[model samples]
Target: MIKFFRNIRQRLLTENKFSKYLIYAIGEIVLVVFGILIALQINTWNDERKAQKVEDNFFYDVLLDLKKDNANLNYYKKFHTKRITYLDTLLTYVRNPNKTMGIKKFGMYTEPLFYTVAPTSYETTFESAKSMGEFNNFKEKQLVKDLSQYYADFVQLENSFSSITRFVENQFEPLMYKLPEGYMSEDTGMLVINEEDVQEFYNKVASIKDNRKITYDYEIILKTPNTENYLIGDMGRSYTALGKIITRQEVLTKLERALNKTIKR
Candidate 1:
């Protein structure tokens, strides 16, 4: 192509047709400029296509994370719901002057209170995208906003769990340790038995103590100051955590729907 253009210029120059040569020269310049613009346009299109692909992959990963988060939150919801039931039972027994509960049953109910699971979040894709400034380039601004809000809500849920965990550690566990019947082992510094699995716990304890029975009157626990108040507070916290889990599930559903629409587009 270059050789053909060169020959045409040489022939025009040799022919001494100055005016025609000038017109041809202008046309060649215009052709060169047009070709450069087309090349640039093609390059721009390729870059945009690559960027769209990256955004798609990011959205796909985020969807997977949201699914995992929903499942985890569901488990937490069930757990808190069950814990609230135990707390309600304990509170009822303590509140009534005539009601009484056995030590074994008390242990079982209170045992669940001491354990807690923090709300889990799967934000790896979001975090990575944010750190790399990928979100700035994202075409779906609403989706990006929704993702930010969702993760922010996750942090709040975690704070809710932390409140209950702190209460158990700082207040509830110490009060329980002060109760009768040696709940903690003097040997290994561990709970002597598992309240949830009473049969297995009894068997293990019996093997160690030649069929000895662990006994403590529930009345002693009931008489302890602030015991009723602690149960109330714990129940409230459990309810709060459950509410957060429920709210998060709603947010997850909305985010998931948005993501599905974006991905389809």
Candidate 2:
């Protein structure tokens, strides 16, 4: 092609017919300009293709992360449900006034109560943090904004959860909830809690149980009176951050399907 153009240009320049030669030179210039424009268009298309691939790869990674997060959150939801139940029973045994008559005293459940039924921060904490970071760094601005507000709210909810956990463990345990009262007796006494005092124990343990249930329930998207204002407000602001992530994951799968289809085509 270069040789052909060079030959044509030389012929036009050297030919005796000046009028024809001038027309031919103008035509050669137009052809060169067209060739340059075509080369530029091809380069621009290649650059866009590479950028879109990078964007797609990042989106897929975010999808994988969100999918794992969803699975983990589900597991923790089940786990906390069981833990709350155990704590309920343990607290009942320790605090129940009427049910204490047994070979072993109600004191048996006191230590286990705190250990087995203690409130815990579930998988949402880690997931929220990861999701927030991903949202912030995403190449897609629309997705970033949509996810950012939601995740911010979820993080606030998680923080309130942490606060409640700390409140129960560090402060409330000492003042409100008492430890197992024990007196070593050489003679065996029927492990007994007088019926009159049962109500008092029930009331105390119930408060703790209610607080724990309220906090744990919030994590699972459950509603309750104890729902902290900070968490509620933040969560409201976030606009279902969790659902957004799930939606994005679903979209990513769809995009993958479309990409696969195009590849086959």
Candidate 3:
């Protein structure tokens, strides 16, 4: 193609009809400029296509991460909810003058520790999106906003868990050791709970007028310097953190669905 254009230009110049040559010369320059412009446009289109591919891949990975995060959030939600329930049972057993402290009450307090450790979210995709500025590449502004909020919520969740951990290590666990030896047996690693006492504790707790409610007054709960209050406060913190995680998970689920639809298109 280059040789063909060059031949035409040479032939036109050889003819030397000066005015015609000038016109042809200008036309040749215009043609060369047009060719360059076309090449540039094609290159730009190719680059854009490559960028879109990269963005799509990021979206898919983000969806996967969100799915994992959602699963973790669900797991912890149920786990924390159960912990709260058990904490409530123990609290009821302690506050009621009629209910005696026994193995059952001890188990209620200790069982929550089985799931006290919070689960961490899958954040690799989110971190990559932030660090690589991939969020800027997204056309939808809501996606950017959702991702930013989701990660921020995760940070808050982590901070909340840290507070809970400090309380457990410094206050709650030490207080547990103060309980009577029969309540918690070190040798058997089981609270020597009587079935009748456990059932009676449950019945009394179940009979409370508002047994399901979580009291948020940490000061009132903590003022007595009782182990029950420390456990309640700790569980309350865990409950609040898990609530935030659930809310964030909902947002993440919406974002994931939106992304999934977008990538399919």
- Considering every candidate listed, which one attains the maximal lDDT? 1
**Deviation of model 3 at 131, angstroms:** 3.8
lDDT of 2 by residue, 1-265 (tens): 8898778777867776778778877988998899999999999999767655655655455445555645544443443343344335544443444453342332332222222112222235335545556434434665544434444444543553454455446633452232222221212222222223344444454344322222211111112223233233323322333343344445545544543433311
TM-score of 2: 0.52
RMSD of model 2 against the true structure: 13.4
Poorest 10 consecutive residues by lDDT, candidate 3: 187-196
Kindly indicate the candidate among 1 and 3 with the higher lDDT. 1
- Indicate the residue-level lDDT of 156 in model 2: 43
Residues 122-234, candidate 3: write the lDDT tens digits: 77876877788876766666776777777776777777767777777787666655443232222222332221234444445445455334433322322344756676787
TM-score of each: 0.84, 0.52, 0.73
lDDT of each: 0.79, 0.43, 0.66
The parts of candidate 1 lying over 4 Å away from their true place are 180-207, 210-214, 223-225
Best by TM-score: 1
- Candidate 1 least-lDDT 10 residues: 186-195
Q: Which stretches of candidate 2 lie over 4 Å from their true place?
A: 87-96, 101-140, 175-265
Cα RMSD (Å) between model 3 and the true structure? Answer: 10.0
Q: Quote model 1's TM-score.
A: 0.84
